[model samples]
Target: MAPASPAGSAPASPRLPAPSRGRRPGMARLEVDRAFPRSPRGVLKIARTLVALAALICFLASDAHEAYTALAGMETVITGLFLLLYLLRLDARMRCLFWPLADIFNSVVAALFLLVVGLFAIIIKTNKGTLAGGVLGLILLVLCLVDVVLLCKKISLDKARGRSAPAK
Candidate 1:
């Protein structure tokens, strides 16, 4: 048998401070804009995302051409990115770019393309899914136009008020 250790002869173990109760280890605290989702732009963006997703689904179900499916998918991603940019308040942090103008441009371009794709989808009349997708695309186009109008009005209002439009 090994010899017994003497009292107080054991090695000391270091003690560490306890972690804070409010946060978990290695997890970042997220700063969410609580009011963003309730704002008009946010609502429109949410609607756009849903509509784009529906259109994409319809095209996929109907075996439409890849171009149609790709357009819907691209719109979904772009809108989602914009939504996240606002929702997370990243736009405020990144002040170099004018977000409103970019948003308006995106809306206009998307509307134009959606118009052509929607019309083509309807004209082809390959199946019910294509028809449904076309209708949704048209609806999305309307929403995009509305978004552009709202943004433009907001910018003009800010200019009239003698103050620069806020980035957020």
Candidate 2:
């Protein structure tokens, strides 16, 4: 058996600290739910990714430039990862693997692309396919913005609580 700790000692785990005078006696610690980020942000990301994929499909083989191709591939991967994160419930566990800033960065980039590409496609040429894809991209932009806002809120709350965005 392990030896008993001294009368005054700290626990072994670094994730949490011993109760302090600042906290109420016998009160349970408040924690962010494991599924917190998965709810609105994950759901919105999935929807936006699907819209992006559909837009890409409509214009596939039409764009000879490599920029659109790279962007399409990125969108596909983003879609897959978003779905995976939701299904696996990895948001709370991802803090060790990556920083929350990555999430914010990705959302900002996706939103910018959706706005720019969508507007450019719509304005450059007036056609059924372009119009459809452009409108879808704009819809995706709105969703991405929503995700970004939610992520920022989560990040701020985590910081205020002295916890990582993915506390687990």
Best by lDDT: 1
After superposition, which runs of candidate 2 have C-alpha atoms over 4 Å from their true positions? 1-38, 61-66, 91-99, 165-168
Question: What's model 1's TM-score?
Answer: 0.79
Q: Taking the tens digit of each residue's C-alpha lDDT, what string does model 2 give over 52-138?
A: 787776556455234544565687688667666656656555655554567678879988987887787777644666666677778
Instruction: Give RMSD (Å) of candidate 1 vs. truth.
Output: 6.2
Give candidate 1's error at residue 21 in angstroms: 10
| Every model's TM-score | 0.79, 0.64
For model 2, give the 10-residue run with minimal summed lDDT. 61-70
Deviation in Å, model 1, residue 61 alpha carbon? 1.2
How much lDDT does each candidate structure score?
Answer: 0.91, 0.69
Candidate 1 Cα misplacement greater than 4 A, ranges: 1-30, 165-168
Q: How big is the positional error of residue 43 in model 2, measured in Å on the Cα after superposition?
A: 1.6
